[model samples]
Target: MELNGVVSAWLLSTVKVKKIKMSKQWGQKAEELEISNKVAGLGLGQKGSNQTSDTEDGPDAANPAEASLLMKIIRQGLVESKLDIEIQRKDPNSPLYSVKTFEALHLKPNLLKGVYAMGFNAPSKIQETALPTLLADPPQNMIAQSQSGTGKTAAFVLAMLSRVDATKNYPQVLCLSPTYELAIQTGEVAAKMAKFCSEIKLKFAVRGEEVPKGTKITDQILIGTPGKMLDWGVKFGMFDLSKIKVFVLDEADVMIDRQGHQEQCIRIHKCLPSTCQMMFFSATYHSAVMEFAEIIVPNPIIIRLLREEESLDNIKQYYVKCKSPEDKYRAICNIYGVITIGQAIIFCHTRKTASWLSEKMSKDGHSVAVLSGELTVDQRIAVLDRFRAGLEKVLITTNVLSRGIDVEQVTLVVNFDMPMDLNKKADCETYLHRIGRTGRFGKAGIAINLIDSPQAMEICLDIEAHFGKKIQLLDIEDAEEIEKIGA
Candidate 1:
């Protein structure tokens, strides 16, 4: 799911403030809250305290040999947590990869032809696990969680087409997304997959535009953003809720994250048939988002795969400790002398920071461009195109290109400001996605983190605990003395 911009830290700041207010009213210290009886009620507490002595000798404390073991444990924990929540298992010997074409999936002949034409042989991880469950007798609600580039788009599209009715075509299936880009992306994917099923009619809704005066609406599938879909419903008239058998929300979590758009999603649900099946897909889903999903879906068949190992294996993780924000700026300047890398992405906590950093980098004679939601969609695409074409060696942004968007030339990812919220408790999805931009398709990469405060160190430790990966600290002032003890 692609969000138009980064509001996670902002949203999390609000959540933190509210929590602090509640804690103060109840007169509870952070340590007290951590071990409170109420926390124990959540059934997430360890048998012993989560706290350990700072002097404890272990790999988590920066020793090389033990740190490697710490990473292994953290990786195991990530996989275990996901598996515990879902009932699916990984089959190394599954025939999915060996299968040459999707024809054996029992799809209609027209659909088979379309699949063949798309040049897809065999199925992706998402398609392999999700298809059979979706095609079973008495269809069930499904909740699929997989990273982007895993072909999740095809899995949901196929599910929608398989159940769509072509006889009375007035939009029997509706797929909603968060942004225009992702909505259009999903619509394009649906069109490609449905091309194999010749009988299915697909039409994307128009905004402030009507389905021509005398034209009959014969499309069996409708794909659009919530706002346009809602607008079309008010203009074109609502279809029979009873006949709409399938509903899919691509990038469901992001749709819910945008407060105004979420209302439209709920309204769509209200208009769907009581027996309609719903499926949701996304790479990063938070606790609040998952809670909202449970209320919307019925007995959903949840399938969450093991979190992919942090792509930092090849990337040298480094941190420069600075005394203040200004010190961080100086450190960034010094980095130019230490390493002349190909290209890099500097991430900030807000658009203001991104803009300021880009200006400073440019002043230092480095080619730089800034990306944020404040720019028009065309402007954003233009920046991306330039970066991909090697015209821009450095790009600054506020989590805009953290996920979904892939640019290969970027060999380094710099975190100017530590991400405040990793979102999920057990997995570092946001952190991994940011670094995954580099070191993609099995190439090497570098991730540099500039730490200027104690809170930043805390965030780093939490990320390390979550991913079980050690990010080495670097003293950029003494480049010759820098050590790779753990990372």
Candidate 2:
């Protein structure tokens, strides 16, 4: 039988064991059996008396390293199984909840084909809970929060495709993001998801995209930034709001927190049909954002997957204490030699700092790219494309690339200046989003907060208190110790 069947049988076999003694014995037997099965599955057969010996003989009796590896796998499997059970038990009324297969959700044939073509075999926890609520009759509004790279994009993209009336070419669905890069990324994903539905047209209203004046948007789905989207709707009169069936606000918290984004978003919302279904998604939401959401999306079903403290557990966070600004630079350069980083992002607080760092790094013989608001839209796109394609190894930027830019190979993030607001206080939200650029999809990552002064250290402490995570100290002098930090 397969691993799933084995897990199911193991779960079922212990259901009727009521007594504590019986339950303990069953648990032990189940663990041993599961471990044995996993060992066989890996083609690591129990070969000699030493390998096949009893558990009480301890891992030293066999290979100590192999025993440690097996224990780690077992613990990880138990954690995943527990999470799956908890998710299923939490939302029993959801039709898509606990569904193992996409076909079980009864999605449209085209959507199903798109999903499989995208290589998704099973529904993620967010998809299992949010899809049914999104696809329900009357199309209720929804507010979902999940960690970065948890299939939230796919969930909402599926919803948008499912709700669109492909027969109508007048912008039936609209999705808004905070940045041009993010907007373009979302549009690309939506296009891929709706590939089988060839009749479904998609439009992007991001910066630098030339939408001819007086041209009507005949696409079935529209994705863009709030400013550009509103510009197209109000200035160019490009969108037909009455025909819009679904509206999505990606990165809701960031969108609402910006200077004019809230007002622009409200204007767009006001123009949409009252019957249009609204969906909001983000990695984090403040109480104020939640209050605003209550007003924008009426009677919404909220699916929050992570609390503040529970988030970003997959990313190992640390801080390097430096004696001066020069020491900080030396520490950063030293890090490149110590860690095996696939890609690194260094976050500066200002464009000037980013430019200076970029120049300095390039002078030091590193392939680096600098991104900030100073660059034109086309320039930003080119830099991002090269970085995403792995042509650039280091990206130095301000807050522009902080949120919603998903680069899978970014294994290291350095908070060079430390994210701080105008009052010189720690900006927890930006800090979270900055580190989130790495650690995509539950992959292990490392974030280094370089601190040169007591104030910066205090700011790091505030961030630690905010997220309830410890920022371990790193000894820059000890190369071996730094190497083992993320390993």
Candidate 3:
């Protein structure tokens, strides 16, 4: 669903990632999704080797496009774009124009080719709604509230690449991610899309990267963290800020919270010429972040998610009543796969717990991976890469990794410890993003919270009350009840 890094389901039919050996269970899940997606009119995309498809088929489809289907999965929380046709819209025509497929965008031939090869058969609901307004000439600024699997990364990457002038041989676009890991993830998606744009050079301005002094920085696209961008663009005179055409802040909520990052981001924004287009994206927008965003991106076309979509109703919420901290280990193993399933993610409150869980799970002969703030940027990327390759069945980490990690096979998310904010209050937003890692696209997913104390139970209850969604008590001892998760 995040297809953020995971390939789209229909396109997965033709994508052959060499090292990843998906199990029969994985194949079955993919097959079901491929079938269901086709029925929804999202057929397969192009495989690199094959250049032609019949008028109605993917280049490598072995079966007919009219194959029988499985149960339909609803893709919810579509984005709605209107600058003000609430009588004051940016373009009276924008709300009326939506593309069913990327082809309708009429992207450059090579750019479109990369899109198809990446397995994006059709634009996600958000993409179809937002791209039209984003790609229009004399670019319009935007502030978007979107969740994982809604195609926010791909949407912005498409916009950045579309506006780049490859022939200029200079940086035309700049994207700011909250952390080093997120910048790399967003870069991975952009690199795949710009594969065919031979002359477009994309650069990462993250930490530890070195550029020679006096060497002209001519990359057409830039993605990095705010501190590094400020250090390189301001402390040093490496970047030519005046020529930037488009500027973006991915995960603006976190950026606003990071100490000094808000000021650094603003500094970078001030250097850009007024004509530069600004875009701010985040899953949840707190009032502070909203205020910060408006200050940097003026008169933006704001996109809001419907209440139903924001509710995370697609993920079933359950809480286990555990007697002690030791019992959480048992609870995790018990409901991991009530039925044959894909990968899973487990969240803990601290790195000490994450390390302990990792050692325990590994000693018990389970294939698990651990990620925390302690990991270096490269270490975190490698951990996510292994998880995506299906080398690890479970990823145990803390809030540090919660906001990003968009693996498609993830079907289960466990709160090894309930999440809480700095003031010890239930963190409804963090809980949503944690479980949001699963249920990508439109697939059903399950989230289990292990409450080991009255405090934890109270925290769980607060979250339930905040979202107006019930968190049912789960009986781990009941087999039949557990098995119904996949149902």
Badly placed stretches (over 4 Å) of model 2 are 1-98, 114-122, 146-154, 164-245, 257-261, 264-275, 308-323, 333-345, 358-373, 376-395, 403-413, 433-448, 468-487
Residue 233 accuracy (lDDT) in model 1: 54
TM-score to true structure, per model: 0.70, 0.61, 0.63
Compared with the true structure, model 1 gives a TM-score of 0.70
- Write the residue-wise lDDT of candidate 3 on 234-318 in tens digits: 5665678899999999877656555556657766876788999998887666555566667667778877665433537679989
> Which portions of model 1 miss their true places by more than 4 Å?
1-100, 179-181, 196-199, 211-218, 227-237, 324-326, 421-429, 442-444, 465-468, 482-487
Model 2 / residue 20 / CA error / Å: 74
Q: Backbone clashes in each candidate structure, one number apiece?
A: 5, 0, 7
Candidate 2 lowest-lDDT run of ten: 1-10
What does each candidate score in C-alpha RMSD?
13.5, 22.0, 18.2
| Candidate 2, 1-487: lDDT as tens digits | 0000001111111112225487866875675455444433432212221221232122111222222222222222111211221122234574443456788778889889988887777877777778877888879788887644567788899999888777776888889987665676677677777778887778777666665445677777778888877776755567777678999998776565445676677667777888999999876666666667667787688777544334478889999988866787898888887877899999876666667788888999999998765555567667877998999999987665655466789999999888776467887877887898788767888999999888898899999999888999989989998889758
Residues 1-487 of candidate 1 have per-residue lDDT tens digits of 1112212121111111113377554553443343333323433212121122132121010111122222222222111122222443245343222233466568877766666566566676566667877765577777878655556777788778888766665768888876655655666667776665666777665333345433445678777678767655533344444457888887665565454565566666666777898887765555655666666677777777655574567677777898876788887766666665678888776666766778887988989988764555557667877887889899887655555455667777888877654231322555787777788666788787888777788777888877777888878776554323111
